[model samples]
Each structure stands twice: as C-alpha cells, then as structure tokens.
Target: MRRLMMTMLFLSFAVGAAACGGGAKTTGADAEGKIKITTTIGMIADITEQVGGEHVKVTALMKPGVDPHLYKASQGDVRKLEEAELILYGGLHLEGKMTDIFENMAKQKTTVAVTRDIPESQLLLVDDGSGTHDPHVWFDVKLWTRATETVQEALSKHDAAHAAEYKQNADAYIAKLRELDQYAARQIASIPEGQRVLVTAHDAFGYFGKAYGIKVMGLQGISTASEYGSKDVSTLRDYLVANKIKAVFVESSVPKKSIEAVIQGAAKQGHEVKIGGELFSDAMGPAGTPEGTYIGMVRHNVDTIVKALK
Candidate 1:
C-alpha cells in the first residue's frame, strides 16, 4: 500500500524537483576527499561512520524519535539520496515507504541493504504470516555484526584508496559489538528466572528476546500498523497476571498508548504493571546522547530493563 502511494508520487515529484533544482550543499568530508554516504536509519549511519572513519561523511534521513515504519521521503531527503556517493538502508521493508525508491535506485546508484549480509535463515519470520523477515536485526548485536560487514565492504568498494583503513575500523567496531553482546548477556541474566518476560509497545524485540533468552510480549504485532483487537489486550493481560510480570516498555518511536492500555487492563485484573524505561526500538536516541549510538542504545536498554524488571 505504501509502495503504491510512492509509485503514484514518484514520477511527479522527481520531475518537479528537477525543474526547480538547487541541491543540498556539500560539507565536511564530501567537500574534502571522503565518500558521502546517506542512510535511512541512525544505526546504519552510525556503523557507516565507524567503519568508514574519517574517509566518509554520513547523513541519516530519519531523526531521533522518528518512526521509520510510517516515514515518507521528503523532497530534501530524496535530494540527499540522489546526491550521495553511496546509500545504505535496512532491508525487509523496515523503511516501508521508501522501499520502492530504493529498488528503483539500484540501477544508477550504489545502494546497499545492510541486512542482506545476514543469511535469510537467521532472520525471524514476522508472526503476521506475511512471509516477510523482520527488519530490526540491529537489536541483536551478533546479527548487527553482519550489517557492519556490508558497511565495510561497501565503503571499501567505493573508495579503494581507503580499503585497508575501512577494514581496520570494521575489525575494531566488530570487537566492540562482541563485547556489547557479552555485557547484555550478563545484565539480562541478572533478572530473576521467574520474571524473565519483556512486554513492549510492539514486537520489535523478538530478535532481542531470542538472542538474550528473555520471553518478549508485545501488545501489538510486528508492524505497529497491525491492528489489535480487544481479545489481544485481554490475552496479554492474562499473560501478565499468570506470570506475575511487573513492567511493560514503551518504544521511543512508537506510541505509549497501546502499552498503557495493557497496563490498565492488567491493573483491572489485579496485576499492576509499571512503564519500564523507554527503549530505542525503531530509532536511536538524540545525536549527542549515549543512547544515540548503537552500542549505547543496547546498553541503556539492558540496564533499564534489568533495573526495572529485576
């Protein structure tokens, strides 16, 4: 449905923009001697910057607290995409509105999906029975290591002069990611075995739970757009009651209403569920904050969950 809408607007928007065109001004590395990379999500942009180091400049389309599931490409964003020397995005329709544009760009641009480096077998199938793989691979640090590999290879391929530097940066970044995974394991294990359940606004953490041994429950389905019926709320409320769960989390990019509703429903049935600290699900934190970085976001989430649930 989103692709269909983008298709209708693509030709008109492209033509109009070209007719009245003065492109975005280049700066920093793009002005100097570095590759200019544009990405759809902060996680992708963060990895690109880390792996490419001083050899690349990255511009991310979606900002903090922006929901990528419903994000549309603005004219400025499209111009950035057109001007970039390379493009990186999460695949599996994570950027639902921009999928078609990315597909059309492959012929003329160096567009890469970071998630493509991971084998399809390792990705989780959405519970919607849609036959589509979940796009939140970054939640699992080990899986995210695959994404950094693609980032490094793309940077090296585009700038052969800096290939060795890119590889070195990638190696260092991968080591940090492994350490992050171990930290998450130790923190997650701190929660009592009887209270090892996580409830959140949506199913963005399926991979996180599977990777960390926490049982995750979301009030809504994989995509936030998936409708939840009265029965869905009641079923989760029952789960909370049966398991003696105490906290449900809200996502930075998603609405808290659904999770709040679960909290209310749980309260009605004698289980008082508190709002766990916000988790950076579809997006990262602000630019300067610790949660803004991928590793920092993971650490914050682990610490938050453990403090609240343990």
Candidate 2:
C-alpha cells in the first residue's frame, strides 16, 4: 500500500511541473504577440510609432545626433534584428555603412525601404559628376509626407487587422506635414533673395535649398565622415567674402571645430561671419522635445534658418 502511495505522489508532482512549464511558455508567447519593429533613425521610429499606435513596439538603432553614414551595428543590434517582425529603413544609402547588412536581413524578414518609393527626378543628384544619389530626402516636407504614406502601407500589410488605425494616424501626420511645408515657405520668404544663401558645414542641405529656393554652400561634402581639406575651406571663405554672407551655420551632429576654422579664415580675409545656430542635419533632437518628431524637426529647422538668415 505504501509503494502504491509513492507512485501516486510522484505522478502528481510530474503533472504540476508540466503545468508550470506550459504556463511559462504561454507568457513568452503572449509577450511575442505584440508586434516588434526596428527603424534606422529616431525620426523614422517616431513615424512608425504614430502609425503602429499601441499595437506595436518599435526601436531605433541610431541614437539622436549620431551620423548614420558611419554607424556600425553591434552584436546586440543583430539580436534586435533577429527578434523584429518588421524593419524600416531610409533607403538611398542614408545608412551608407549598414546598407548591405540590412539588404541581407530583408531576405528573411519584412524589410521596407521608406525612401525607395520617391522618384529619382525629385531627388537631387550629386553635382560632382559621380552620379551619386542624394540621400537627404527628409529635408523636404512634401517628399517626407509620401515617405510616411509608404510606411503606413507597409504596416498595413504586416497587420491588416489594424489597417484602419494606421491609415487614420498616417492621414493626421500627413496633414501636419503639409502645414509645416506651408510654414517653411512663408518663413523662407522672409529672408531676402541674396540673403537666402545658406553656408553650412556640409552639403547636406542641397535638397532643402532646392525645395525652398535658397542657394546652399557647404565646406564639406555629402558624407561628414570625410575631412574638409584646406582647399575646400579656402573656396568657402572666398565665397563668403565675395557674397558678403553674414551667418555661417554648424550641424549638431558634426564637429564644430571644422566650422570654426571656416569662421577664422573668413575673419582673416576681412569678412565678418558669425556661427548661426546649430542645425539638425543628419539626426533629430532629443527624444522628448518638440524637435524630436519629424514635423516638429522641420519646423524648428525652418524657424532657425529664417531667424538666422533674415
């Protein structure tokens, strides 16, 4: 009788263990049920959150003010990519260094290149005759509205049940972008024709100038990773002196020492130029601030340019 009791007790303990294991598995599955997404930059992450609403969890690989061109992913980033249900990236080589890795991941997961939908004609090509594409499509509010719509479309495909919510959020965001575009037009108009020339640390503003009717000159090229040689500095200083450009701008993501050298060169040439406010070029502002969001970022940039140039 004692032997029979021992067998029964062992069976009961085994059943309890199986139940506990099943409960743990169910909890993990529940956590995974929430859709996980990853984006290349903070601005793209913000837009994805707006469209995904509470149904999705999103992570941005690049931090605020980090230069994406030179960003390299770590081992932890590989885990993030493996766990993500979908990945969104700004194409056109904005994340130049990570492009190949992302392309390989697309074969296994749902990867959407948000800027790929924009037409080539609208993109400003590099004038150095290298046929290189300009990756700064976000500078134009109108173009960015289309990019946001592409994101919404990709999200709808991933979660059809939440399509209506995504569309509603996208429409609201696009309306805000339209308002920002109009505001930028008005603010830029406040600057006089000759004064509209924007001299900055790099050529990142080419698309912005094209869209807003301003002449943009940069001390460096498209990629901030490259050094601005003495020849580039001399050319810019001469232009500033000849055109009498008053305000030279620095990018928040770039080193200020290079830009200050330009100012010093101008001074030696008998031209007075001041450091305009730091502009958000390659990255957005802090996560919680107004300049953090896409529309808010453009609004802040426009306000800064107008206030400085005018």
Candidate 3:
C-alpha cells in the first residue's frame, strides 16, 4: 500500500510540475548562466559542486541524516527535478522509492546515475538473491572516486565548453579521495586483528569492511526497510558475547533504539557493548559541519572506529 501510494504521489507531482506556468523546462543554464543541477544525495551534490566549480549551481534533494533507501520525493522535490538541467542520483536502488520518478525525469532532461560507471566486478552483491548489488559504494573511498569521475563526465557532456575545467576539478578531488582511502586503511590497520569487528545498526558498512579489512556485523540487513525481530537481537547478542566484542555503532539516519536494544540484550548476557560513536552510513552530518562533507564523514568514521576498537 505504501509503495502504491508513493508511486501515485510521484505521478501527480510530475503532472503538476508540467502544468505549472513559468516553470518552463530549464535548459543548460539559468538566466544567470549557471547550469542548474539537482542531485539526490548530499554526497553527490558536494562532488558535483566541486567538479562544476562556478559554472553550475547544485541542490540536493536528500539532506543530512536522510535515509535514501526509503525516501520518497516530495512535491517540491519534483519541481526541483523538473527545473534542473541535469539530475544526478546514486544508482543501484539507493533511492529505492524514487527509481520510477528518476526514470520519468530522465526521459525529459539529463539524468544520470553516479554509480552507472562503476564496474560490476567492484560492486558487492546483496545476499538477498535479487541479483542486485549493494548500493553503498560510497563507503569505499576508492570506489567513490568513480562516482566523482561520473559527475565530471556528466557535467562535461552537458556543458562541453567547461569540459577542461571539469576534468581539472575532478582530478584534484580524486587526489583527496585517494589520500583518504590510504588514511582509512592505515588507521583501521592499527586495531588488533581480533578486535577489528565493527557492529552497527545495519549492513551498510559492507564496502567499508571490505575496503579496510575489518569484520562488519549489523543488527538489520542492507536496507533499513528490512525488518528486524527478537531473533536478530538475540543472535547478535550471542555473537557479541562469544567474541567479546566491545563496541557497536549507531547510524545518523537510523534510530538509535535498535542499537540500544542490542546493548540491553548484551548486558543481560553479561557482555558490555558500548556505542563507539555515530557513523554516517546512509547520510552525512548536518551542513556547515566537517562531517557534512564526504571526506570529513569518512575520516570521522575511521577515527571513531579506531578509537573504540584499537
């Protein structure tokens, strides 16, 4: 019922955007000569802005702490999408509910997925047997470099006059991402191998674990939309007690109660599991803060994990 309602709502928004006067379809740029780019997640928006420099204006539909897996585009979001000359989204079902909307918008304007260019060999398959890979590629900084390149490629294709500038900007951004990847690897390596387990609210850290060589366990599955029950908690509790795991982490987008419940369950079993710190899984921190940026968010997570488990 919820999916059906959201789909209907999306259709209405699409119709309304077309019917509204003076909301004429935006071409390459606005009257100010800046390409209007709309992105689904802040991470993509930040990269677009960095690559676009002064030639493009970017707005993100999903804000900090927003869980993109369950996010449905609002009416205002539809208007933004309609007005955008180029739209960039995290693909592979990251924005699960808005897939149809993005598809419809693509037929009208330039819509691209940052993950479209990422190789399938690098993508981790979701164990759900759906034949779909995990969408949390951003967790691996090196893999995220491809997303930056994708943004650059899209911008270059849309506005060829600024292609050189886009390439220059993307090159600089990729350098920083490479450094961050190295830092994460070095820091995570400092933790004793036996104590390198990372338990979190969900399985969003699969890429992070794979990239940095840490064991990751989650109370819930890849998508938070998946339900969790008492069995899940009890099983995690036993795992924590048996392994003598010391800390778990909460997520910025997911409710803390689930992790809290796990803590309580561990306590009853005579095992203590402290929350290492909040990790930016599906979403980054608030705007204007360091954590709001992709590099800062990854650094914060790396530092937090190293502090707790090392």
Error of 1 at 24 (Å): 10
Predicted candidate 1 versus true structure: per-residue lDDT over 185-207, tens digit per residue? 98999899888998888889999
Worst 10 residues of 3 by lDDT: 20-29
Candidates' C-alpha lDDT: 0.90, 0.86, 0.93
lDDT of 3 at 263: 94
lDDT of 2 by residue, 1-310 (tens): 9999999999999999988784632211127476788888887898899888888888899888898888899987877877788899988878888888898999998899898788888988876787878888888888888889999999899889989999999999888888888888888988999899988888899888988898998888888776789998888888889999999888878888888988999999899999878888989998889888887788888888888889
Question: Residue by residue across 172-275, what tens digits does model 3's lDDT show?
Answer: 98999999999999999999999999999999999999999999999999999999999999999999999999999999999999989989999998888899
Each candidate structure's TM-score, on Cα atoms with residue i matched to residue i, is: 0.91, 0.89, 0.91
Write down the TM-score for model 1: 0.91
Q: Tell me the spans in candidate 3 whose CA falls farther than 4 Å from its real position.
A: 1-28
Can you tell me which runs of candidate 2 are displaced by over 4 Å? 1-32
Q: Which 10-residue span in candidate 2 carries the lowest summed lDDT?
A: 23-32
**Ranked candidates (TM-score, high to low):** 3, 1, 2
Q: Is candidate 1 or candidate 3 better by TM-score?
A: 3
Better of 1 and 2 by TM-score: 1
